[model samples]
Target: KFPGVPRVERVSFNKGPLELVRHTHMASLGDAAHFEVDYVDMPAGFNDPDLSLEGGISGLTHALEAQGARVLTKEKVVRGSCEGRDTTLFLPHPPRKEGFVEGRAFGSGQRYYFLMFVGEEDGPQLREMARTFMESFAVTDGCTAQPAPTPAPSSPTVVSVVEGTHDAATGWRKIENTELGFGVLMPGAARHESEQAQVEPFPITHHTYINEDDAGVYAAEVFGEYPPNFHNTPGSYETMLDVTLYAMKRNFEPSGFTITPLRDLKAGTFPGREFTVTNEKLGAQGRTQIYVTAKYIYVFTAFTRGQAAASAANALERFFSSVRITTK
Candidate 1:
């Protein structure tokens, strides 16, 4: 007999025809946990006597009392009859499935069905589906204790993260070995604290050092304590690319630009490109070795002595062709 819902129509009270009547039978009680179901099957049709309805209700009340839930609290609910057949429909929102899944009792029979509203805020996506099931519910009439419906099995996929670390001794060592060392190859140094100022206001939890002097370093930080719910942020690879490209082109250059075609390599082989351009002003003719590998864009510069600029360009081509990118 919750104030919100006007009635409780047990389908068992209906005769041959499907009729739903909303009664004003209402009440407010203590915790709904203190309730029970009792069975009372009346003869078919609206011709059943008023006592049949009262008997059905009395039987349920008796069953409830027998179950020891009848704590005589001051709780009160409205009660009455429609085309009476034994039933205690209009009452406190009945104890529901979640509360009764283990099994329940009312008297010689058990009653199923409790009221609940899973609001949209609880989980917005499945609201319509849940409402569809709620609207289709039919009240039971002739009392017969029945087993509760089987619950829908949940299917959830779980991923586990295994924590560990890798040693750094395998890579080519470059720079001062003060833990500030840069491994030209891929092995990462042991984890240590970074001394540079974080580029952004967010606290930095992870970072990498290519040049310690540049303290203008690669910093990975986040505002919150948890990983972001969405991956809209860029990582080290993209950030480094942007910073490097910006530094190279901040000032105008004379030779313009030229990009060679990419050559695909077979397994165990390295894929890369080669290109050449000259700066007329610096007279600084240089040969550039271009090796595009998994971890980096290695562009090594070798200056041409005297007027060997054109020859150095050809040498640059061979250098790129000979260089290897290996994962072994």
Candidate 2:
């Protein structure tokens, strides 16, 4: 947001290698009040291994120095509970300016950069504003994290391996329907169930693979060859996924249910949605992610007895990541 800068312009371009969106908010009068955020996805092999927090900070320092800017200070700090570096830069150009830079690294070669530039570094008001802005930064929605359970989850991390792998600690095994062209990794002991439906538009079938432990339940459902029109309509994939979610939301039996929509997700490159549902009628709570591949839709759900089953969180994450869909 540009402060009192009435004319703010936004430009988005999908063609270039740089970031897709940019807000050109800084004033050419050199007032020095500037704040900008950007994301960079550094591919794994692109000068990384050095693409992490420390490496990023070091790189920024060098780039700033090349522009006649002297680095005033650099220190490692935990801002917003994320590991990052805080650096102050002094640029002695025609428009003398000083700025602060904060950089945070996300896994899989992603990085978030926060930059604030101002006319003078000695101004207490400007320094206070920059400090507050950097310290308050947070990742929400897709990256917002829920608090850990008081006792922590019993299986906070499920290190599962695909079938035929030599490791026994891989608590999961792979299940594939070659005919269906999809493969999934499920808890080692899950079994399959399928039924054909005599519905309108033909070839409709329902498949479910499920298993339960004393503490929880894990299940995946497949909706094969659903109504063709449903998939053919524009935006139908998301619409149909929403419809499925609605069906899950409304069926709480005798009582109403509470639903929390989590972040949207992708299975490999396929689109998906993730959410949690509470079936008040059954006193059950679960997290589910559903993905689609042309003719087949996959729904993975992991649930336990109550509202906060931390133990199932990792399992749900793993289940979503395990999906492999080849149809298109």
Candidate 3:
């Protein structure tokens, strides 16, 4: 007689969590009770749980009854006994499937059976391995069952990162995730790698990046400066204005150029660099300008066309209108 674990009790480990154990007469074995579910409740807006369980178990009992099998339920535990010629094996309920079944294999003369019940705690983690092991017990007479099914592994999900700007008119948006920072986002309609590649007759050489849209055009220059010590001279007000205007003329010269100074005083002061609206051929016809106040120069030039120039100027008016300097 293959009597099961004699005594069942919960135990704790010094290194980790607690576990349950089952002791037997000959050699006691550990309890595989970690996945046992003590209780469960069906939430609203779900199918009827009771009816489903009844249907599945009823079908299983019917199948076994047809094969002249007797059903027995032990009220309380009994001492070991092996009197019956046909053996019956008691198994834990299948964790996942909502149905159960029993089958008789006449050729092999073996009876296959299984039980289905609502899952307990840790149901999900135990279901995959448990289901495969139970399914392999297919009505084998003297033959050994096939191996259990193995589950495929899974991987983690990934996320992307971006940066942006915020103001009263337009909200926040991320330009891009980059190593260079905000200046890299300056628009470019056409861009040249180094000052040497720029249009000829322009004495100052620079590495430039440019951007353009109806709002405005932006041209940035990284160049050598007057002091000969490039870094020291950069970030100064006047020097920055010169480099910015130079880059603007270079960009718009293919057409023509003119500048109109506004008598209306805007709230801010133009630093060493200045921004102005110039007659330039492109979207809208007014120019949006920028100045760099440093040993080296960086410029952003934007222009608008015809009536559109006014709108472009307004959009970028902040460039010159908002320019200011601090003593600190």
Candidate 4:
């Protein structure tokens, strides 16, 4: 069990001859935050001595970035000859009151990913918790030397809402919303709503589209004046992009979601950032795209869970591919 985190529950998964542990604490409060520790088996052929600890971490960072995550900081910690890599990542949408932090380590022939969150004011305490957890961790070589069984498939319950005629072959319809300045192909009736939101020093308009059924939920948010600090200069726009991304990160923190690194993305002619996040507790996963134009920021998000998540692959592909940004 990890120190300082009470009531830790240990869960395990089997991958062929290898077994991994996932330690979780579902209920925590105050300076203490939600914490989890994952032990992963190194893939076969990954035991290369020439692959220095830093190189391994760099590879991991690159993989994360490829998946649309942004790495905030990375450092090396020496625990004797067993060198470990520590990294911090930004969440996609952080909570309003608290910040999210994920501390990961790989060394001693073992890989571990630790998750903990802190209030904006509890940075020091969060670091202490991470240090304590890392210091107390130990790697074990315990596994049944046998191939694991193939898991059975799951039957998912999906509910979808659709209006108007659907194509017999594709089961979808085209949707064009001129007010939102975008068009997409969807599987259901898209509900649109507008709200006023405070994005730092300015009040912005938010247009949202909601389409959900048992299968999954597809949402797109068009944020008016997203980077409230944009000044038209190259440097200023870059700063505004950072600020906007930070705000998005904060929005996702409350759900305890793990985000992939942010990667360069393009929405038609507009270049932007994209990433995906998974919330195990909610049994849901999402892909998000953030695009900023001269006047607004556009966020496209798709969410699904369980069987629906896996089975809706085709629909999701068509929906995203059909997205056309009509605003300048």
Candidate 5:
């Protein structure tokens, strides 16, 4: 991917000046008239052989047909059981024409779908561009896909904070904060704390969950009113993220620090940014997600230290995956 955004690109794929763009919608492609690719990262334990790679390509073709397109050729390509299909689509009203070639591939525990279209007369070029883009496409190692969020149940009962050992019989316990309008699954008996602070003009409420024995900490901060000046429009989101990261770096003051590029992510239904930070000298690692909603901004963070950090990996993932924003 291209650092923070959910975009992947290759420098020189073809002579037609081929470009690849991935997103949820066509209009979102903007000037990317070359190719449109959409990729989804399946969650851990999603190994189902029945969901063949061909099925994925077929589904995309069906979707195009639903949008008033005619398929011309459909066949399998030799790339981890990949498949490619070509179609002709007519624009609404005056029937302006275009041709599309789509391809799908599943391998190395990930899924990818790409669609490229141009004028009907340029069908040959469009097919060549799609082939080259797919051939060069790759997902970087150690960069797993983020699975789709599971829908939370309605009217979930809020679990009260209990002291002493957690009930292992029940596994992880759910802790909900009605005030902050969010909930998370705690690893075990966790200490909870909350406080009010000023994040600029906004009054922010911070909540923390800590497992002392495991040396794992999960935290959430809710801001009532985000600064209007921090609005993330196009290139501005990076600036806001930089401000946040700078504050974090100063607060930690680590001997060695490394941070991943900010990536657009989702917390339940809320869109957000997810990133990782590590302090090798301190043996500390953290994953943080920040969401900006219409009325509030939410920041969720998880961190662990030392040897215990290794064992806490599963717990940390569970804690993050189980998070649900309860408020509308």
Candidate 6:
């Protein structure tokens, strides 16, 4: 299925009455993408052949909804059944929602759930991947885990060439730009990039600052300014927050890290969300935070390699909390 930079992983687990088996596949940098298909078996005693799966949240549907809330946006769902098994599919926006389609099967003794996630990039192939998965979803009377597939031949990896241009002196320092009307704390010199977003009819400038930690890992603080009073529009602030967070994820993804949003990030006027970042190849893990202002949006995130979450956690919290926006 993975024609480009083919790499895939599979794992299975059984926890008393709960069983989960997942298959993860990865592609190369340019066409970088992640696709995972999950099979879940739970001990839920639901006995009703004519039950309405979409009537209300209960049993398998209830559990499916809970998981959907985490991975998918709070959008309306497509309801029906797959192979006579009641199903609820969550079609979240790509790149942001990371391509999650959730469903479940109702049966006595042991119920089943099917979930497929595709992220990083989207195209016709990914849609086909989803279609094929759902078309094959069903309840297996005697399902068993398959042996791990043999590893494919190694291939060359692609890395980012964007290097830090900030020549400021070393040591943790406060980065400020009065012209831009914002300041932030950065571990070291940060690379800067500016470009016009690919938009039809109209386009806006986008700016990003990326800095590196002592461990050779990198962190980014991205900000983009829009037209006058653009943030005044209804839901403008929320839109900026969501778009900024998604941009930050795309920024880190090229380096082989996976990101997942955990919340909507709202408290009064606070305009940002929290995210978890992981890199299985490097064993690095940490969180992401980004705050949006009236006319400016920013994202600052970092992760530590082979260490506890403490190092990256402190930096991330400090970096995000220390932001001061004059325009806000």
Model 5 agreement with the true structure over 61-113: per-residue lDDT tens digits: 55556566666665544443343333334322235445454545444444444
| Model 2, residue 40: C-alpha shift (Å) | 48
TM-score of 3: 0.30
lDDT of 5 at 207: 53
TM-score of each: 0.22, 0.43, 0.30, 0.46, 0.41, 0.43
**Global lDDT of model 4:** 0.56
Candidate 4 — which residues are off by over 4 angstroms?
1-169, 198-203, 225-229, 235-238, 308-310
RMSD of 3: 32.3
Worst 10 residues of 1 by lDDT: 213-222
Better of 3 and 4 by lDDT: 4
- Pick out the ten consecutive residues of candidate 5 with the lowest summed lDDT: 11-20
lDDT per residue as tens, model 2, 162-186: 2422224556777676776766666
Best by TM-score: 4
lDDT of 4 by residue, 130-240 (tens): 566557654454222222322223433233333434646567765566655776666777776766543223345677777877667777777775342234333333333
Among all windows of 10 consecutive residues in model 6, the one with the lowest summed lDDT is 48-57
- Higher-ranked by lDDT: 5 or 6: 5
- lDDT (C-alpha, whole model) for all candidates: 0.29, 0.56, 0.33, 0.56, 0.51, 0.49
Residue-pair clashes per prediction, in order, are 14, 2, 38, 24, 0, 0
Q: Return whichever of 5 and 6 wins on TM-score.
A: 6
- lDDT, model 5, position 2: 18
